[model samples]
Target chain A: MNVVLLDPSEVRADGGASLDGRRAEHVAKVLGKAPGDALAVGVRGGKLGSAQVVSSTKQALELEACVFEREPAPKRPITLVLALPRPPVFRRLLQHVTALGIERIVLLHTRRVEKSYWMSPSLEPAAIDTQLQLGLEQAVDTVAPDIERARGFKAFAEDRLPELAAGARVLVAHPGPFGPCPVDVPGPVVLLVGPEGGFIPYEIERLTEAGAQGVSLGPRILRVETATLALLGRLGG
Target chain B: MNVVLLDPSEVRADGGASLDGRRAEHVAKVLGKAPGDALAVGVRGGKLGSAQVVSSTKQALELEACVFEREPAPKRPITLVLALPRPPVFRRLLQHVTALGIERIVLLHTRRVEKSYWMSPSLEPAAIDTQLQLGLEQAVDTVAPDIERARGFKAFAEDRLPELAAGARVLVAHPGPFGPCPVDVPGPVVLLVGPEGGFIPYEIERLTEAGAQGVSLGPRILRVETATLALLGRLGG
Candidate 1:
């Protein structure tokens, strides 16, 4: 863990807090901190700063006080629209995107997306938080990404997408004869990535009608996770 | 598997080849290919095309004929110099980077890296091949990436790096007050990445002395896997 991240409620007004569980274990073992050692700390949905270790043990740690005074990493102006993948893939993607500093995520089921994926326990709120928190700690960021589930492709594309992507350049990544994916796009980008086999032809047509340009990532096909990071990285000016 | 990759020796002069093991199992089960069904096929370090199944059983298949006429994905020009990570992370990275079409990987040890990481089974040839082949299958590429072992930081930087990095722009991804990493660097690139805790000051200094420029990947710290993808993605013009 790069930073010790805690919910705002976890810290008292006096800037003191008690931490246990994974974070505590990380402090006790990975970091091997002694009492009075200053630690990098951050408040969820808030700023980043430092805190002093008041007491320490194998399973828990107490902070004498906390002071979150620095701003976290700048949030990227991107909204990721991803087809729900298998549970394991979904979990890893969640953690990676969160670490990359995305502010919003829209999870919708494409035609090829297995319906079983939505039933995955990884979609649970607590499980989702665990992955996102891991990301926040990894990137030393505080803004938890807002995740919205827009049931299926048609509903999301025909009803919700038009308005949601109004001022943003929406790009759907698919293989075909199309322009190369844009790099260093200015302003906001709504990147839509499909399932493993890619969005069906009709689905791509619908997305095009919804004002998203189909962009090819070349002949080399990448896994959705790799493509997501690559697109975001290339687009992040 | 995107492409059924076979060694040149696997195919005869008459274009007949019998596949067993995973590829055969995939054809019999995952792909459900029937006799006379054509499947995309490629030869390692060679061309990509299709093959027709002449016979299929639960565990093996016979190809009536194989033809390789198409080229695989264009090989990328980046060479990655990574500080050895814990085994599991290294395995995932090996797969991910290979899928990204990297042609060369130079694994080395840095001060922050644990000595035991070198003893990992993941470093074994067969184990490494498993990961690389996974990437080749994922990207539908036929070429296996070349792996080089640069055992120690000092020796590699002082001895090997100078000549290997001579004409290429060598950029070390390190966090600091350095300028932003250059994107789409012209020609060849020898990109060096440090281990999790990052290279100590002295290592960074020696790297700089070896004609390597330190480039910052911005404030957000990314795991070596994510950062590798991001850097290579942004640099792959």
Candidate 2:
């Protein structure tokens, strides 16, 4: 873990904190910290600070806080409009986007998406939060990106695209052609990636009509999960 | 697996072949192939053919080959110059690039690369072959990308860059003020990506002076593995 994350509730009135569960286990087992050892800590939605180990036990560890440093800015201002993938793929995407520090995520539906995928247990709020948390831990950051779900493509394009596209670069990844996805895009961007089979031709046309630019990754097709990361990496790299 | 891959020696004069060990296990356990079942098979450095199961045993399976079909041309002609990553990450990258249908991979040295990485067991020819086969199987292609290692940066750049850059688009990935990686590159490309911490400023300068266009993926930094996929996806997509 790059940084130890603490929830607001974990903070004591006198600038101290205690960790339990996974965090405690990580400190004891992975990091092998003992009393008096120093650990990097960050408060959720807050700043980063150094924590001095005041007490240690197998189940929990108490720490005294030092000063807080300004947190790094979150990743570029981008909104990812993704087609829901299989549960395993979704879980990995969540962690990846979180680690990359995306600002927002909109999980949407497309023609080829299986209806059953929406019912996956992995879509539970707690499950999503857990994966996002893992991403934050990996990046040593504490900020959480806002995530929303769109039930229909038309509704999202008609109802949300106008406002979302305002003053933002809109790029949609698809197979056919419009030219390659640009490398160093400036300003805010909205990246739309389709399902496994990809967005239908009609859907691509509609998105393009709605001001989204059609962009290709290259010649060979990629799995939805891999494509998402590839888009982010290229656009954000 | 999308396509079954066979070694050059696997093809018999009578067009009959048998698979043992891992291939046999995969056919029996994963694919659940039975006698008389048809399977897509590709011979290394040859053509794709249809194979019909002739007999099956616990330890081996025999097949009868039919006609061969010419394999499709590579999606794009891109040669990847990568810094060696960890074993697990390296394995994943090898498979990923193969799935993307890349034809060549050159693993090079950079300042941040750990010397110990050269000793990884995953670097063995057989092990590397296994990973490449996984990629070939996924893409259902018969040709395997060539993988080479470059131990000295300055020496290789001086001795190889001139000829390697001939008649090909060359781009180096780095963070900073470069424009986004261009999409729909017109010709063949030789793309370069640095190790985890990234190539030092001097290294990037050297590459740029040697005729590489410096480019950025985006604002957020990505892990080396993620960056590789992203670079391929954008360049190939």
Query: What are the Cα lDDT values of the candidates?
Result: 0.88, 0.81
**DockQ per candidate, 2 decimals:** 0.71, 0.30
Task: Give the 10-residue window scoring lowest on summed lDDT in candidate 1 chain B.
Answer: B178-187
Clash number for every model? Answer: 0, 12
Specify the CAPRI tier of model 1: medium
- Model 2: runs farther than 4 Å from truth? A32-37, A55-58, B1-71, B74-88, B103-130, B137-141, B148-222, B231-237
TM-score, candidate 1, is: 0.97
Q: For model 2, how does the per-residue alpha-carbon lDDT over A64-152 read when each residue is reduced to its tens digit?
A: 86456767555668899999988988887888888788899999998988999999999999999998888887766788789999988
What tens digits encode model 1's per-residue C-alpha lDDT throughout B1-237?
889999999999999999889889888888898988999999998999999999888778899679999898777778899999999889988988899888789998899999999998899999999999989998899887799998878899899899779789999999899876776666888889999989999999999999899887678888887787777777764
Candidate 1 lDDT tens digits, A41-94: 998999999999988787889996799898997888889999898898899888
Worst 10 residues of 1 chain A by lDDT: A228-237
Q: What is the TM-score of chain A alone in each candidate?
A: 0.97, 0.96
Best by lDDT: 1
Q: Can you give the lDDT of residue B156 in candidate 1?
A: 95
Question: TM-scores of all models?
Answer: 0.97, 0.72
Per-model chain B TM-scores are 0.96, 0.95
